[model samples]
Target: MLNRISLRQMEYFVATAKHGSIATASAQIHISSPSISAAIAHIEAELSVQLFVRHPSKGLGLTAIGTLVLQQCEDVLSQSSRLYEIAAESSAAIQGSLRVGSFQSLTAMIAPEVIFGFSRAFDRVELQMVEGDQEVLMNKLRALEIDLAITYDLHQGDDIEFECLATLPPYVLVGEVHPMAQLRTITLEELAPQPLVLLDLPMSRDYFTSLFAKAGLTPNIVARSSSTEVVRSMVANGIGYALFNIRPKSNLSLDGKRTVRVRLAGENRPMLLGLATYKAMKQSRLTRVFMERCRAYISDQYIPGMSSSAFFDRYVSGS
Candidate 1:
């Protein structure tokens, strides 16, 4: 029988080629640099061809032969992924495991309840949760490291389908002592001059900037933090006010001072929170059931007035 390249060696080679550096690839795959070099050397020896041209300063560069081999390697990897997908579909049982990803703040607030309910209902299905910022979660979803993700409105590509679960209206959180706390509603003009504490995440930063731009006002951002709790704390401490879409269950306070939430007058920056999955993947029976349960839960618990008829008409049409 003719000698064949192992999947492990192919994986290492593909990683090195994609990264363009052995050290970087090793770090990514959690292997040592010497091990990677040795694997590449062994693969080259097996094929009797040099795969990469290593320069003293410019790092690894692929030769023409290397490029051809890399293209074949990619095809092999794709076929391997498809094979796994086929196996997963064949085993189509909801009783196995599911890996879910979501933003940190959202996971902190909503995921616990949902997970708890899901576990009670589907006792055989094991749940694994990964929490991060929007970008991290989305990247993980694209990489196939997660089965599903719940996140804010990305408003971009149509590759990943979105099933919007809820929409939260925008509101300003200010310390009880702040001047705006007394008002029932505040205008964008009234909020423009104040120093703001922003979430500092990409989605939030862009949303707030667009909101201010529409009002012909530029906000004076004095503080920027990725932590939602920290931003709420800053607002509670009277450092600055924050604009957020979610309606917090409990008032966030700093040093015993409660922050008041006031609806923004004539302002509508309702965040569309939803479940997202790749359109290419085969929808498992469990996934479909989970989605249906999610829709039912949202309709019965969150938005009572919003009917399933309306939800399907808007977000789930042709989904």
Candidate 2:
């Protein structure tokens, strides 16, 4: 009788016991209440024990035998989970569910090439993508909600392992008709007096502001936006100049307004784009393969949807 019990039945039984109600367990596990009740009854009948005592007002209380059985069930479930880990570790094939998280701004540009490309290359792997700011992605990594993150090296603690793929330095964006648009390169001092459109994101905001702080200059921020595209659009409309690391393939904003990318005159701190994963989590084959794909696709030489870094030298040097 015990041999006839499936892992799904055991899972249903454990969920019911933990929640103390079939309906509650069903809701949590996305199973029907009748299915949970049937699993519990089957387990109780097979073991010849009254697993739970029900009350009309109260939900259910575990019997002494149920308490003991619950412990055994939990242990069995734990062991059963290890089997999958063992198989994955031993298998050479790259096939499994890979949950990837990316910075919100990068997803639109980088996903088509790096993410979808990987899926097309490896047909067996099931890829799930999530996008958020640095803080959100870090939280997701720690909570096991995401397997890895595509982001910059920002506020990363010892618990995170980051691999650098590219170095992106800050540049200015302005409408084609802006006063500074004719200039190939501009300095922070020159930008200080201009009305700025700020990218107001968590760690990103701090990083951008810190550059001004280090140069002992204050930006005259006339506008702020959390979305990168919004900031670009504001700049294109001649509202204010903006700073950004990403150089979109097109100089045109989302609304088809023309914008210019002016290189910063002096060397500043460049953001390191990289892969971030939970330090303690062992890399699965799928994760390893995905990381490999990212490395092959993105680098100092080239990035998916951004202009090449080589052009930065020609612009800043006035060559």
Overall lDDT per candidate, in order of appearance: 0.71, 0.83
**Pairs of residues clashing in candidate 1:** none
lDDT of candidate 2 over 199-274, digit per residue (tens): 9999999999899999999989999999999999999999999999986767899999999888887879999999
For candidate 1, the C-alpha RMSD (Å) to the true structure equals 20.9
Q: Top model by lDDT, which number? A: 2
Check candidate 2 and list the clashing pairs: none
Worst 10 residues of 1 by lDDT: 307-316
Q: Model 2 lDDT vs. the true structure? A: 0.83
The residue ranges of model 2 lying beyond 4 angstroms of the native Cα positions read 1-92, 315-319
